[model samples]
Target: MSRTVTLALVDSAGTPLGALPSFGVPEPWWQEVGSIVDGARRRYGVEVSVLRLLTADRAAPPGGCVSYLAEVGAPPRVPLAPVTVDLAPQPRRAPWAQPGGPARSLAWAKRELDRLGRPVTGVNQQRSWNLSAIWRLDGPQGSAWLKQVPAFFRHEAAVLRWLATATPDLAPTLLAADDTGRILLDHIPGDDRYAADQAERAAIAADQHTVQRRAIGDADALVAAGVPDLRGPTLARWIRDRLAGHDTSVVADLLADLDARMDRVRACGLPDTLVHGDLHPGNVRGDGRSRTIIDWGDAFVGHPAFDILELTEGLDEIDTAPLVAAWAARWRAERPDSDPERAVDLLRPVAALRLAAVYAMFLANIEPSEHPYHRDDVPACLERAAGLA
Candidate 1:
């Protein structure tokens, strides 16, 4: 599938230039802007950085033809006429969505890297959106990552620090972090293990179980570390409130049974602990021997089963069973009294509710243009929950 992007070029001063012809690229994923940037550089012979999405055409959630208002780092060296187009300021803005936000983030990363004596030699913006802005910074030593998250996720730095202290190897090495949610991390040298074998998947699941086990009785400490308390009751309230305004008439019966199902999940005896809210194979990075989990923006304190559900999300029943068994075995060994198998069964609908609430939260906070990224997520998850009911 091919995806295209139309750029409304803007100078560093936020002055509108002209619109570039809509360019097509093989990679159709809309949110991943690395290809879009590379395409602009390759075809137009100009360096451009995407600031935020302006409007999407034929966009189906994650991919399609989209128009973005981008900042031009330098004038185009090649003589290619860009059509005259009016560039108006976007009414809705996230901090990183603002024209100056990317520059400021880059400045802070450079300053911090300089302080660490690892001045940047090159930069590559891998992703930019409302949730986070990520850049790969290269220096004499190696590549490091500079990630700036929104205010809602300002707690990520603290969460990483807590993880470092408690379970050192599970998270990335934090080089430097500030109050603005910008974090400099030492790059883990490996491809994301999205295609790990069944044995490897089992092993990774066990490792996360260990991490969650360490946080078993430290709910207050985890909260103090800036992790949100999405324990049973808290998440329940969020689900109810999130689904309140939406027309959930079709799932009305399922919604009514939500509380009882959640209570059964609680009764399964799995203690609430640090849940890796978006735990999946794609988020794990390693070179066969060692593995590390990345992206803690969705981390929360919730039932341990939620992590298992996340880990085995897209797997078939045969493949998912072994991973879940390995994860549950560790927990059952740790808490001999707990019934993890039962918890996994009971938490299916609850997990769906959690996903719905989270996507709803994303839609509420992000700019309108970016809303398409998660617009259908709430209803899709609710429908899944109803089906699972």
Candidate 2:
């Protein structure tokens, strides 16, 4: 029999505020989603609302994705407070489930805010696995972004904090960070742009390359100081293992070729430096007027060439040749002694590995057919990665 799932909002008193239309799904999956929503509500108390109920057969409505309203049965006089929450599927399940428990990472963020002496005005949980939260805090004189980082994201927070210190103008000013991995940063507002004029794009790329070099230097120092390398063989092995589960015979062969190529590229020993582990266009903001790179969670110690490859990997329709050529010219201009050809060669496989990793990740987290990569325009990305490999 076909399974059905119910979506409902309950008040503080556990009374049903509203019942959404039931959706059909496989029995097991339906039960799983229901349990998750119920658990979130019970744990968060009356402040929580069940915004959506996704089913196997139908896509979630855009408007109903997350509920901002407080639970129905709260104090009658309490102003109707609105909050935004994003609920995406977890990348992978946590080893332990603590329903109604304080998010382990949030504790760190709260502590860091207290250390900075900032009052949090708003907090929103992202729909990611690592217990990430975006918070707006009343800064000494203005507002700032307070991000809570779980153990999985410590590396990213460290890299960003370091960058902010090293290049104050290029990066957001770091207000505070703590052992728990929460980071308080100056808030910068701008829209993310993928397509920009050649000059603007080139400028952003050059700035990114500069930031990457600094990151690499910091990583080397950290390694020397006995900080464990977070992007070492362990991560690569994990990627390989996950890829092995896929049934893409054609894609698998392509990925294997790409892996061998990356190995050779790595052996060549191009300049090793800190790299923005994920340098897609989406991570960039501002038009020619202003620009900033946001989201440093994937920064890691790696070859600069590989980092460039990852940056250009996502633009399938737009010819990357010009952008690449521009990057090479800028690199040579900055470091007269650098070998442009060698750098290009090294970045090729790095780009391929990044593509493979992102594709695998999206597939695992989102359904295959519904993934953005499955769209027609994205085939160019896969093909481009193959060409680079």
Candidate 3:
């Protein structure tokens, strides 16, 4: 006998999109929904679709409530009547509420939205309260993207606001921000791209460098004013620190080589700049004509070379040399007196450090235990950083 599990997708109005059915008899069938859909599509030649459903575990306010059901599953073969439940109307908590309630964030977003005269539309409770809402008005001042900010999300919003103000022509316009860090900004249309061609890639890198150079001056002033530096330690120090805990002879030899290269890196001495912190192709947007950077959570004060490193991560090694050369040429053109060769040399370690740090962060947060890339690539990154030393 065939066994199946059913799921539903409901919107903010509590309306059901449809019921999804999965054919399986496993402990956690919900987790394998994607695989099941793919298998079904391949085996039966049927198009499968999935929708995000928001259902609360307990009747409570939107913020404090949990999305007991928000997943992708197989659509039911037969239509079923929509089921409605009389859920209690409790005070909504901010979606970003953790083990301890962050009531301040809720008050902040609400107050700001009220000032803008807009209602919260769609919200994703996972990975913090990520709300994508719209505020509509008449004329040119119509439509804004409202986002709720948890403590961790403040950096991203701050970076976006900074870019919007400093490089208005290059970034989205900020409408308003509140004490709780909730933000309302002008929305730009276009999807982030992963695969960019040579010229287009060079152009985006140029724009990023321009913004970094401009922001760095301000960042240095912030440092001078006694603001604690958020940029992490230098690439050399980071490699040594990670190596202290690592257990591998290959890594040890690589670290020795990296130690020797420290002088070379110091001699290069690339100037500090306001780095985007994460500048991979995935975070970059636009056709060769114009580019937009999304997700600025990693913004920090660091070497411009470090930003280049982040951009080239996961790409094949064969492409690194030419890309680095192109980037250095652009940097020199912008700052005519600067030595492009020295800057390019500095990028090697900067790249290593950024890659290692990011891989460590990803292993800590995103990857599963059985993922081989985490087990292997992370150590490989450390070794590469050591080699750069």
Candidate 4:
């Protein structure tokens, strides 16, 4: 009835690890499946661990199931076969079809932590394009968050490191990083600003403005870190490409309308700068003293209004007027001769279209079987675009 995400583990020699010996659903299922890698290491001195999910199925056996393809150190002498898990796992779309996709992720986590001499007390798993396994340390060191990213997101760790150096406390301290898109950080405390008070909301806007200012000085570095320079026209093209996959007349009409605005939507004379791609309250956290922005996966160089518009859309009941006015004033102070209201008015339709197109991109990247959770998001974004238009 419910949906699930699953992963399969294979050793370096290309032998399957077989099914996990768990029966009850989701909770214990994940625990027992994790044990398979543990058992291999303890029993056979094998160093197998990393795993990431690949495909999802709404009608796969007992319930909606998603499967992960994993990799191990070497082939085991024991017999190997496919694993059929009948447990509910957290829902996610499979990003890659290649062997050892999400499967190898866990192993990497264990290896990295061991290298840092930080024995993990617990681990939390999340996935979008790749894996984010939050490691709760056993003692002393407390905790840290590690994110493994896709090629497009490879610069996140670098960006964090650069920001940590340039704007102390603005971003989480990047403890260490690798060239392959893996970054470790000291976790910052405090609930996200998603349901924050008015003052806290204002602080987030101010902090983000500061970040944008600093970002201007670090423009070349941001690009080197892998953040793309996306403008209205670039954004429009991407949106059009994504919408083209769908054949609905409404979808078609939406694209046509977007194309008409393409000329104006193209990059204008306004100075493009560092824009937090997903800057809702949820990504901005902490108290007024130290507002921390998390998740730089979508940071890019674009119109400043892109970030402003995103923040505006997420201010659910926190009185956006003052926040907008204050944030706008700061923006104008940063760029004299620019009007926030006028910028937002012009950016609104384009931003909405960009978001709608992004949802479509998410849909295209994921397995069709994983559509249940993601399908509605596309239309919702499209509707927002229509409303803005």
Candidate 5:
């Protein structure tokens, strides 16, 4: 289902003028707000861009995607209530969000934290994504991060709780999780370590290997907790389906290769384990003493090296060897009969393709303004995949 975004107009006096209820599907980013600004111009006689977006904690003011708060030049002439406006639909925002703003979301966050007995003495950072963003809430027990997820994103709290039973340090301790899918997690406090050497990253791969292998038996429980199985055929179909919408020859060649050799990708001799779908440096937090993995949103059940593949971002074929060895050693230690090199050989192309597809999909959906962020990099990623192929 496409996402709907609601808007709240703010008058010159800083008072809110209620939410703009009806909108087109797939809430757009900055560029897509022009129509909304025009709406305010036509109805309120003022051109506006002072848009502040937030997601309703629950069912959006009846049927809206999020409760957007826009700064209007003055109080709206119409009654301060939800208004409907038709728009040319554009695909963007995720399929979960409700009508609520910073105020409502913060109130809900404070309430949820209070219910969890974690008082918000201070807020470290403000939120962004409609109201479905994550924020660090300082509390009596150090600090905690309150994250609001979509109705369909599954409960990470349960997965965290389960992970805590074994490798408690591998994941954050769950503070509270409600039926609405808001998860309060203990914030790992410390300074961000900028540079991570191969050894430091190697330890992370090993840690991931251990945690994933231990959780293999409970795949059903983990998937039940919302983690997906993205290994083998699932990935093949996913890459194929996403690329089918594009007509570029670069993409066509990639698709052809995938279609022809996907069976080899499926037959890679590796044991399926808990996979952290994205394992780049930015996602891992280390304060010198320890490392904590963040953002399991892309996690799935897949090959072990796949979990650590993102770490090889800038490395050439030669540099990725040691990292692959470290990850494979852990897998080999667990399963003596498995051939790590063979598995790596088979998955190398698929992994590169997977990473390229990920970037390609992002490039396709993103706006021109967003292009700067990926212009040089995403194509480079595709080139790497093509080189591997």
Candidate 6:
């Protein structure tokens, strides 16, 4: 599907300058504002940064004629009369979308880089949404990333902090961080492993298994560092609480045996450890010689099997046998008595429920305009879990 965009332009000083003519963009995702900003610069000679989505004509999110409030660097080089548009600041805006929020983040990043002696030569917004806002900063040294998350995800930096000490090469290097969720990270130099071959994926899974194995004794330390403790009983309790009052038949079926199912998963004897929480090939970055996993905002302390299932999520057509076998073999070697394969089998529905709960948590915390990005995720995950059952 194609997408068209309109920018409700505001000068850097926050003066409203009306709306620009609608233009088409190749990207359909509404939250991916990189293309929108690039399009404005290329077509209208206006360097702009999208603050928040204003309005959309799509029946659902991620497409159609989407309008956004953007902050321009300066007056456009080529001026033209445009339709009047409201550019009032929004209430209850996300931290990154609020007035001067982006500027403040950029300023902090610049200072942090200067202190490190890596002066930033360029800045580009890679993504922006309620969950997180990412910007790529380039310098003579190399590229680095500046990321800011919401209050609910304030633990991301802590997770990375622990990982940086525990397995430095396994994740991006955390350079600087603050309590308010802003972090500066040294860039992982490689391409996203979205198309990694089965053997490569298997090897990656094995490497992550090593991390989880090492973390088993440090689960409490991880939780103390702000990682959510989602062990079997805790996860079951949270899912039960979240599913309460849901009226769907599938949800009802899920609730009926949720506890019993969780017990079976625990009976597999696999100990709870650090989970990637949202593992997938796309989250892995690498060249042929080395690999790095990125995006730990979803990291939590949970069953390792969750990562196994997550690694192959949505790649139904690809053969995942090798990856699963490799992951399970690692667990078996570590804990010979544990039924790693059984844990994978029994946790299928539980994994889906965890995903649904995760989406529910995200929707509860984000603003209404950003809800469309994940509104259907809870129900979709519920339906998927029911099918797995």
Highest-lDDT candidate = 6
Comparing 5 with 6 on TM-score, the higher-scoring candidate is 6
Model 2 TM-score? 0.64
Each prediction's whole-model lDDT (CA): 0.81, 0.51, 0.51, 0.61, 0.60, 0.83
lDDT of 3 by residue, 312-376 (tens): 66667677667778778777777666675775564565566555655554444332311222446
Clashing pairs in 1: none
For candidate 6, lDDT tens digit of each residue in 105-183? Answer: 9999999999999999999997887888889999998889999998877888988888888888888998899888999
TM-scores, all models, native as reference:
0.94, 0.64, 0.60, 0.71, 0.69, 0.94
The C-alpha local distance difference test score for the whole of candidate 4 amounts to: 0.61
lDDT of 2 at 116: 66
lDDT of 4 by residue, 1-389 (tens): 33343335555544566643222224222212344344455554544443543455442233445454555555555444567533233344332223354345545655667777876676643333332333333335667666666555667776777777767778887766776566777778876778866776677778778778877777766777677767556665766777776643544555666555544433233456788788888897686567789888777877777887777785554576777778778867766766666666667767877776666766665445444545676677777766766
Off by over 4 Å in 5: 1-99, 126-132, 149-158, 179-181, 251-254, 257-262, 316-319, 359-380
When 2 and 6 are scored with TM-score, the better candidate is 6
Error of 4 at 222 (Å): 1.8
133: Cα error in model 2, Å: 3.4
Backbone clash count, each prediction separately? 0, 3, 8, 21, 16, 0
Q: In model 2, what are the clashing residue pairs, if there are any?
A: 43-100, 216-273, 216-274
Q: List the residue pairs that clash in candidate 3.
A: 21-74, 61-91, 61-92, 62-92, 63-93, 64-93, 258-389, 261-389
Q: Which stretches of candidate 6 lie over 4 Å from their true place?
A: 12-15, 75-92, 244-248
**Cα error, candidate 6, residue 126 (Å):** 1.3
Query: Can you write out model 2's per-residue Cα lDDT over 66-149, one digit (the tens) per residue?
Result: 222123334333223332222333444221112221244445555666766765654443222223445455535467775654
